[model samples]
Target: MNEIVKTSAFIGAQPYSPDEFEAAIRAVGAERYHDKHPFHKMLHGGQLNKEQVRAWALNRYCYQEAVPRKDAAFMSRVHDRELRREWIHRIHDHDGLGEEGGGIERWLVLTDALGFSREYVTSRRGALPATKFAVEAYVRFVVEQPLVIAVASSLTELFAPAIHRERIAGMLANYDFVDDRVMAYFKRRLAQAPRDSEFALNYIKTNALTRAEQEGCIAAVRFKCDVLWAQLDALHYAYVTPGLVPPGAYRPGQATE
Candidate 1:
């Protein structure tokens, strides 16, 4: 692990010591993590109404569904037996192993509490175009980018635990509909994200040996931040302030009781 340090010379600089490179990547998360998005701020501050919260969960389901697929695509490209073995846990975490319901299933528990039918949520027909595009772009990014960068892209998990903590606390404090059961998805992630992120950060630091490679890792994290931030931008525009729900996207009142 590296001590956090600010640096502007991430790109086109001389090769960094592993600690400097790690610090540089962590800096990217410090500045660009989607926890800073206003939508999240509103969410954690209890400013959103139930419909708005429902909208967030409905839209976020799309991202949850795409995660396993992206991990699968990344695993398919890796030839290392040990790496593949290690990476397969991510896919299993989302998709589940046999009898255990995984993250996707846990997210649906939240949606179910929100009054959405499993069929409606999974069909994804109501998801915003922006959400669909951003998530698909992430999968495609992992498929198309170098393995190191694709792996590095998942470093967003490095920043996930804090947001999950805030979410759990805020929703529990503010909403009648929220409870321990609905919050299971986030509670699980507090443990899961740190484990996954540690593996990814270690991989990036140990494997990204040159200045150019390290810069690519940083760019990958930036691009992933864009992916996450863009989803909230769409959500906030459609549901929060301007309130321009896209033509085919989920509307606040559409969920079934």
Candidate 2:
């Protein structure tokens, strides 16, 4: 029993080797990204009540909104024009050109379909403190980390495609309130994630020549996983447990009507 407890309590101490670093990256994605998170499991299982779902949408918008800015930061750091041009497409993917497109707009379309007022979702007034911290940590990671690490931080995208597929299928099947059109953002993400992840993976595998650089790249993905996991932790604490919802954050009562 003690051994079982110890093994279960272990927190990932496998030192990475340069040759095995790509596998290490895949292993982390297989194990730690939010797709494996219990909240997501419950969400896909349709166990969360309406308020929990709202909390998810509201909090996740913070993440969605930050993607472009972080991509811009990473793009800014790239000295290669071709690389810069390739990466800048991520910003366009999220922010869009005029008014009829972009990830942020698509996310708003999701929230609005879920019954959240456009103004409220855009205001981000009810986002959990942890969501703010986690998302901002990502933006800061891209802005401040070495370029390779910055690129590696986005390896979370590798895991997202599967999760997005599951989420879209599950939500459409189980929720009377949700449908394909409402979840268009994820549909876009399904394609965007793979294309983005492939580019990032190729970049890392090619540029992370030194053992230390490879390890740092892996560590950056781990850091990003922690950021995503922390957001769910805060959501679970505030909304799922003894129900200690934070001040100014969205409340069940507010959405009860």
Per-prediction CA RMSD (Å): 4.5, 6.3
Candidate 1 TM-score, true structure as reference: 0.94
| Pairs with backbone N, CA or C atoms under 3 Å apart (clashes), candidate 1 | none
TM-score, per-candidate, Cα-based: 0.94, 0.89
Residues 103-146, candidate 2: write the lDDT tens digits. 89888887887788978887888898889989998898888777
For model 2, the stretches where C-alpha displacement exceeds 4 angstroms are: 1-19, 255-257
lDDT of 1 by residue, 149-211 (tens): 899999999889989999999999988999999999999899899999999999988888767
Pick the TM-score winner: 1
Candidate number with greatest lDDT: 1
In lDDT terms, how accurate is model 1? 0.90
